[model samples]
Target: MCGIIGYVGADGALPIVATGLKNLEYRGYDSAGIALNNGTVDVFKQSGEIDDLTLPAEHSATCGIGHTRWSTHGQPTDANAHPHTDESGDVAVVHNGIIDNYESLKSELSSHTFTSETDTEVIPHLVEEHLSDGDDLLSAVEATIERLEGSFAIAVTTSGQDGFVVARQDSPLVLGHGEDGNFVASDVTAFLEHTREVSYLEDGDVALVTGADVTVYHDGGTVDRPVQTVDWEADAAEKGGYDHYMLKEIHEQPQALRQTLSGRLDTVTGDVDLELDLPEQYLNSLEEIQVVACGTSNHAGQYAARLLEQFADVRTTVEVASEYEFRGGRDPWRTLVVAVTQSGETADTLSAMRRAASAGARTLAVTNVVGSTAAREADDVVYIRAGPEIGVAATKTFAAQVATLTMLTVYVGRQRGALSGDRASTLLENLRRLPGAIQQVLDEEDATREVAYDLIDSDGFFFVGRHLGWPVAMEGALKLKEISYINAEGFAAGELKHGTLALVTEDTPVLAVLTDGAKPDQTLNNVKEVESRGAPVIGVSSLDDTTKYLDVEFAVPDLGTLEPLVANVFLQLFAYHVADALGRSIDKPRNLAKSVTVE
Candidate 1:
């Protein structure tokens, strides 16, 4: 996904636009560009990071639009960057999603001269054609959008036009309300430094923004959108004192978990007061639970599925969102399809949720964003109240998702009478102390970092666990490979003899997660198998006895079934330190973006 920002204000637009692009760099982009509208549109572009771009010393333009592009239709080149313009160079457009029918549209406009290899080039030309046919700027943009196909969040500005037009169809776009100016951007972070108030644009909506006002339209009718204030402070997006945002976010997990659990749990009554408006009849429907997610969120879903099945006594299944198909075979009436996502804008997860809805399943979204597509489309929604997570490899949100789902398990168990009062009280009390437990892990970061230093030169890494530890193992492998670029694999301890054992070598460090609920002795036997092959063992456990078998041991707080969650923080630190040592990009890993908005 790319980032787009536009501003119509009295301040120098170029500087503001450039700062916004820098804020969005975590989205992962290869090129950056900006278009300034003074007496005429002046476009500047580069084929590298946003920081590499240079602006004119002084420009009279007070309005402009900018883009940080992740190449899709064309390779990463200056010509392929955004702020594409028409032949006259009067109109400039910065777009975010794909134009699915660009080839046919290009063929239809054979007489037009194209300067760039991008699907976005057709947009400005089409708008120019409409303007030549006696349409105003607003009408031209609206007509151009009608002819285009597929997802897009586009911002268009012309030299002589008094305002800019932005449209959204199946992509994210938000408007910022400011006293000195009006702004449009792909994400709230782009404009958070300028304004906290924003209005989210829905699918098939168009808006025209001027220096002083903003007007929105949906289906040819004028509409008034709600203005919501962002809760995250502007400094929250900044790296306070840490060397990298990834490390800073890793340290923020304890506070994030505390915020997630605050005031929501009633330990006195052992009740979870989620306050979600789902009817009791829907909650009482006894059948099955299906969780759909992608990547790290899918791992969280796997952990939640195990807890839901164990605590709620419900038949639960976890499916990767990209591979889930909701065709007409299964009875969806009694199924609750839970969509788990951090941004809530993942393309695959959104498609999966739509299919589940079409199949008559009761859909619920567990996501972090308040106005995300998944939050708006699902039958019911629960916010994972984990404040903004900026790192490309997720840290805080993963912990928050698992914690929230654990609480959801408690709620379901209460509704189904699966857990008695005393047992529920005990679980709730443990949940209340989870933040302190995780804080204990955070306090032991120096030890984890030391372990990371010890295993920095490992040829490869293998992670193994059982039961709830299995998902923790998977997450640990994912974090290490994503950030450190290490060759790593995670397996159930029992699966080692099947095929994974062959890959174990003396140079490969085997990381074993030995927690309370996961059969510790069985995993210990698996550890022995790897040890016999001369593979070094690094044990992550709360127990003291397991350290005897390990060359190095990382201790986590002993929280019974909750130990796996705390153990994850140590693994996250290990990956961060390893990546930092290797001089890898810890915040923005290569070839990976923060949100998978495109398929």
Candidate 2:
């Protein structure tokens, strides 16, 4: 979850490096820096946004590397920012992702004074120290990789070397070659001004980039890195035709889910391909299944667990990633571990994958980022196919995850012979209709937007539901708090009386969900309890149910197999609309950052 940029061209390198870092600013904004060779290596770094940075007027060099950091190893500060240099100041490094074993390495480094809290600082120092011991720049980088643990996509530069040295383990890094020179970045955006043709680096791969050539290696041997064409325009990554990236992303959900469900669903076979190529014995032998995720993804996991257990007849547990590994109840080896993450950079989920791997379990990842840490680390990975969701609130990615997991449920059920042909057909049909159902709710945005306004001004908001909608309610509350910076709570409707009811007060908004048809009466009962205590009630129910016992009512498409997902999207829109009305920073909310790379 950071950005890296490197360049080698006849043009003066500092300005290109600075501009590239600015383009990567959206990915990270905490700190910015660059290292360029102007006879001697010149490094400039500062805390805060790149716009506020002041670099030397000129660094006369044709090769450079830069970084924009979202702090994980240290707090956002100048002392801990990147472009970290070695003791001799001859070698400098810029990095994205984490170095998990840095603490041990830091303790072992008695020869250098560590100036930064960043794990990235360890690289330049290690490379320089290794070079001091007589290894060339490429050999030193290779040696350092052997001693390092955890995810990293690093670019190292030295005044003496004629090229940029790059290495990757679990993080993303790409190289773009141009007639002028060669380039590197965490994504295509940083170098789109130069080229559209790029090469992707796989785990344990290294590349050496110079003005005339680009060579790749694995371990210590030469390797050919496959070059891929990036079809997305530079402006597609921009806020095209929308005021905010959040709104555009929300609007993109329909196509995103469709693409996610397309090839994976097999209508004739009534199964999902998953693309995992999981062994038949392993697929059939699973005694239990576990899904680990964080934030909105956890809600998707909850629904998947319930669906898999009910429809597939597999015992399933959905656990929050932040707390999953420490929970003492589950045997990891006997379970199929499925880790869900949108960025694929979530630290907790990655750690949980390691825990599951250590316990000898089969591991799978469902993620949106191709070649992400979670994707590359897991034993098997499912791509959600939701391209580039930039909004920190995560609308399209969440919906896409749910759709893919739904197909996975049916796939596992069909594989295990637990799902009857008729039942599988019904579920697949419903899955196909989900996009339309969601679109119907989106068409009624005016009603939900008004509801959002009413709740935005309230003192406090509470969301409650029974059964499956409980997770939806939690997600609704999370969306509100995440973007609007409001105080909100989501509780199981049945648990309202157990001390949570005390928080209900006049002017407090309570959103109650009744998608569980059988529990409408019970859900209404819970609403009555809150209404009796003077809380304002807003009911989200089926479009067919015209009757309203609450102060406000929001209708949603009522399809089986978690119909609330459609309803939940409407709630997500509500939260976003309300946050917008309040003049809140809908994309980058205060005190929050996207992709928690640290615990």
Q: Tell me the TM-score of each prediction against the true structure.
A: 0.63, 0.61
lDDT of 1 by residue, 1-599 (tens): 57889988878888888889888775546689999988689999888889888789888888989998865455567888888999999889999866767878999999999978788999999999999998888999999999998668899999788768999985679999988999999877888889989999999999999888999999999999999988765555345336787887787776567656765677888888665766667667758899999988998999899989988888899999999987456678778899999988999999999999998898999987655789889998887766567789999999999989988988888888897777777887877788888878888888878888888999999989999889899999999999999988887989999998898999899988888866677899999899989999988876768765888887777677878887888888888999998999988899999999987
- lDDT score, candidate 1: 0.85
Best by TM-score: 1
Worst 10 residues of 2 by lDDT: 234-243
What's the distance in Å from true for residue 424, model 1? 1.9
Model 2 stretches with alpha carbons more than 4 Å out: 1-237, 326-333, 516-519, 543-546
lDDT of each: 0.85, 0.81
Model 2 clash pairs are none
lDDT of 2 by residue, 1-599 (tens): 67899998777788888989988887677788888886578888898889877788876798999988766556568877788999878898988766767878998886689888777888888898889899888889999999887668899989788878999876678889787889998878787877888988999988888888998999678998878777666755345335578887777677566656654555665766665676667767778898999999998898788789888888888888978763456565558999999888999999988888888788999987655788778888887766566788888888889888988888788878899878887788777788788888788888888878866778878988876778888989999999988888986898989988888898688888877522555777888898888888888887455254578777767677557787788778888888989999988888777789998
The candidate maximizing lDDT is 1
Worst 10 residues of 1 by lDDT: 232-241
